[model samples]
Target: MTPTAPDRLVLVGGTIHDPATGRDGVIDDIWIEGGSIVARPTDPSSFRQIDCRGLVVMPGGVDLHSHVVGPKVGFGRRVAPHLARSPGKPAAVPTIHATGAAYAALGYTTVFDAAIATSAAALAHLELADLPILDKGIYLLAADDVAVLNALDRGDACETERLVSDAVRAGRGWAVKVANPGGAVFWRKGRGDHHDLDAAIPGHDLTPRRLLERLADAVQAIRLPHPLHVHTANLGLPGNWRTLLETMRSLDGRRAHLAHVQFHSYSGGDLDEGSFGSGVAPLVEFFNAHDSLTLDVGQILFGETVAMTGDSAAAEHLAHTTGVPWVSHDLHLSGGCGVLPIAYKEKSLIHAWQWAIGLEWFLCATDPWRVALTTDHPNGAHFTAYPHLMALLGDAAFRRAAFDRIHPAVRKRSPLKDLDREYSLQELCIVTRAAPARIAGLPQKGHLGPTADADLTLYRPDRDLARMFSVPAKVFKRGVLVAEDGHVRATPTGGTLAAS
Candidate 1:
């Protein structure tokens, strides 16, 4: 069924916090017409007015990175059936139906699955079609194609650009993504020793660095809204911070987005337990200085969540280390992914440091425009943890108490012990809605400026940021009231937001 526009509605007398327009906490009425925000209509009787005198209004949230659909997510659900049958509620990997309802209830109107192999684009889109109330798109795993690598290896930049453009167009994809570029060659060969970003592809001349440079160039040349989304090589390895730094440098001012960066920012080498700690300082400094890079910190909250990624080697390492039931599958020559359940314990040094380093990245970064808030969904933690993560970022006292409970060694060595920055409400808005929408190339979805989509969240302000954000008083999706007070009022089929 085709989606129809809602009746004219007016959210009256709300304290609007539209960061895009610099309307900070100003009391104003917002008008909606034909599924888009508009100027006040002339005929007052045509509108249904909702009194929002004490409510706080902002653009509906945008999740820039998540693993909400496709084969790997399905595998996660099948492998851990008990995960969805937890005593209190369902699993971390929610079904397609529940995922949409859950996100809408939390006030997010848009979400992008960060990695989808080109081969699985059809399957993923089928699943995404079932996702309700949120506009969705996927970043095609273009760089994982053998032909794409061969083009780069042969120094055919034009061919590489054409291949990327054609793949995205055919797949109806939103952007290009390269997960552990050239790492697939090593993984197929079972060469665990070739974990370095500089290492050459086993059968080709292309290295991960070269692959990134060429792919980044292609993404820009094609004039795609998003830069190439990269899950850099050496993910989850000790002393991988150097690898991440090198990966950023390889872009050489070309725009590219680094995904799930917390997993790639560890300080240790050789997987030694003692050598691991916060390695975010140097990376954060370089990231702040480099204007071309944008990232999402996959913040880990204490709990059980599935770790799933297209980096097969990293997934294998994690599965082996945890000695847990895991699954990995090859997608012909377009790379692969692995999934395993992980429990982050405050008493575990590595897990505690992971929690701290993610915060360190959030606190130390100088610009909110270049950063996005995410858990890489089900990787670092579930997307539902966003409210808790926001609380940790907004309240220093709450953060310190959580910090004190973590492993003692991490408390001593991690830089989070001294960082005093607490994100203001406006800043949190940027990371969650504004910056992500901008980064994802969706100009109309992130703000309440006239001509933007009528997707908004209204909350009754409270001292507790988590409680305030966890249950929005009202949510509007394209001018329709889809959710109210944490319950689904209407289930509208969201559009598949792919590039033409």
Candidate 2:
């Protein structure tokens, strides 16, 4: 018989944490070949091998939504001159190349730049192509684009379908995202404030609710992997949980995801959130009953991070109130984007209250599988805070320690300090890895299972959960080691998963 190669790359003697298959801390080997997993090979000599003994091996992370590389991001960079001088904030957020490198170093092997307007798609792709070590994708921010909005108002489902496909194909996008829906047009119309879904957009005769439903139907009609990713109307307002709930109710049979949901769920409908934590119960209940819906926590970590969004009005509101450096761009009235620098303070009443609400949503939600974890990157907080957030969830003592340092009034009123539920490693896998990829409609990206994609990470075991996740011992993208010992290695190849 002729000698044949094993046709596999074996990662041997590693403890694999594959939440998809319920495999935890089992010192087993994983075999990868041709960018997919395979059965373990017995003949070690025939296979290229990596020694991963005593390491916590898991699938690479998948970020469902982020604005790391897109039009709004460029707008932000252009607007904030002083922000350009900040230590972390760079000229153009340290370039697309740096964006990919930083994310990969943090063990995120796949990231979706949440909102790229169809008109600005080419510009987004230009940067995404240069992104290395992470499979990149984009969501088309089509809120009040005239042609589609016109078609929707006329009840032209056929034309709407055609336009949706045309836009996605032209944009080379992964999914659809609607930012403040009809309000984008209203902002351009000089209204600058459309608080309710029923409020009219300037040129179109449609309400935000109508726009939301139609775009969601359009996305579902073509059988897109992900649903309409929404930033929702009236974000960051007190009593906005009503809007959030109403938004959820409006998505009847369709799969609609709410991005940065923590920002949208507020207890009191106010400029200062006097009745904080009041809106959580109903919102949490609605989420528990709804399975078609998906959400990312967008948990606020107390620190200064650049806030950028496709919703110009919302950003402008934030900028004006905070009096921070702001940036706004008008994209032919279809929608605009705004950027501002923000900080969540431990001593400030509103910031402390906001902090409590975030943790409330995390604990109140029934299932980890339904909610993914994110800082909404450079918005609520930087992506670097993910490790610390994980630490809070994993260690009760850490959560209490952090909670004790907050403003006294907030500490007295907050439910988070009273509620104690330490999340297991398996639960961490669900929220951070498995849930995000599945919610983003990438079935293969998050799991380490038979025939799964060969992107994986290995961490050294430590009681300090934050440090453990912050620096993985070895990180892989498409079966290739890309980062190790807190540094990026040889530039490795990755994919940009998109729907044609």
For this target, which candidate reaches the highest lDDT against the unseen true structure?
Answer: 1
Model 1, 267-353: lDDT tens digits are: 887654569876788898999999989999988889887888898888888988989989887636376688888889999988998
Q: Residues 1-500, candidate 2, lDDT per residue (tens digit)? A: 11122246889999988888889778898888877887765665777889999898889988887777766777666665555567654343446777777778888899998877778788888888888878989998765567888888777889999998888888888998898877677776679558777876777677788888888998999988888998888878767888888888888667998898888877764543566554677888888888888888788888766788888778778878888778776645355568777778999877887777788888888788888988887787767678899998889999999999888988887778778988888788888899998888887888988788888889999999999999998887777677887788746656777886
**Clash pairs, model 1 backbone:** 84-91, 239-268
Residue pair clashes in candidate 2: 238-268, 238-269, 239-268, 239-269
* Residue 459 accuracy (lDDT) in model 1: 90
The local distance difference test score of each candidate is: 0.88, 0.80
| 489 Cα displacement, candidate 1 (Å) | 0.6
Evaluate residue 242 in candidate 1 and report its C-alpha lDDT on the 0 to 100 scale: 83
